[model samples]
Target: MNLFRLSKGFITEVHRLFALFWWESSDVEKRLHWGSWDKLCESKNDGGLGFCDLSLFNQAMLAKHCWRFIKWPNSLVVRVIKGRYFPTSDFLHATKCSSDSFVWKSFMWGRELIEAGSRWQIGNRSSTLIYEDRWIPRRHSFKVQSPRVLGRDAKVRLLLNTSAKEVEAILSIPTGSNLDDYLLWHFEKDGNYSLKSGYKLG
Candidate 1:
């Protein structure tokens, strides 16, 4: 006397369950159709019947992490999992499976696809160099190229400011020179200029 018993078996049971939740005839029909499970889960805008199976949706959501791991294997979450459970290898073998659940395998497959298309860039704001879509050790050190000062006055100011003592030492060279040049040279060499005294470059 299980009251829910029907000649159509599981399909009838599913339909009955849908009925209790206020689904219309069209919804029941869509759920009953033996189409691709993925298509059935999609939104109606994508041309699929909008029937969400929550358990499947949860699995799919968690499956995204698999892709994240493959994209950034050295990321914090992946690192923790690698340290705690996968210490011995980069790739997890089927036999050594810790979880061994079907959902976990599905996630791993998604990760594999992400890993195949991964690429990297190395450089600063001014320029960048691209690297292959594989896990290779980074061998080169990157540094920002010193920007060149453009205007003549700006260049003089830059030279004056950077390594001021060195510039003053160079200007102090006793080779015969013009009065203006000689006076300017002495001003810097004596380290008596107001700007030099006021600013502590370091």
Candidate 2:
């Protein structure tokens, strides 16, 4: 007894590829309802049926790991985890990380999709990571008495090189820009940004 039957779409595709085998089967066994596919793919709790969506599940699990790396980039444990499971590619490589050497590639491939500004959530629940967005004016304390009055080009240069600590301080002023945009620009230009000790999550 075939307790579980294949979905109609799957059956149709299989039959197309194995027409000879299908044709040889009895006519009574070949019949299948089109509605059965949707029912079989629905969750058991929903009352329609029980079927696993392999592709969606894979994407969800990969997204979880992507969250992990962003939160703990410098952890020795993270490195070990990547090295053992994904040894060859860089941590941000765009390939899937099934083995020890592919972690970096996996991260690279999915990084943009799970960016800090994205509104994606875990398991269709609350937001996965908390973040704030703001724009900040550029300034150099040692060179200029009133850095905010500096020209746009000068401001950009100042903000780009300013340490995170200084940026945090200037951000406190009621200015045209906030810290969020400054951080985003810094990361975009430099490819890396440092988070203050308190800003890092455990």
- Global fold similarity of model 1 (TM-score): 0.31
Against the reference, the lDDT scores of all candidates come to: 0.37, 0.39
lDDT of 1: 0.37
Error of 2 at 142 (Å): 36
Off by over 4 Å in 2: 1-28, 36-51, 80-100, 110-113, 116-202
Q: Which window of 10 residues has the lowest lDDT sum in candidate 2? A: 193-202
RMSD of each: 24.2, 15.5
Q: Per-residue alpha-carbon lDDT of model 2 for 68-113, expressed as tens digits?
A: 6655766887787667545675444434534524444444433443
Q: Encode model 1's per-residue lDDT on 99-150: one tens digit a residue.
A: 6555445555443323332212211211112121121221121111224333
Candidate 1 runs further than 4 Å off = 1-19, 24-48, 91-202
Task: Give the winner by lDDT.
Answer: 2
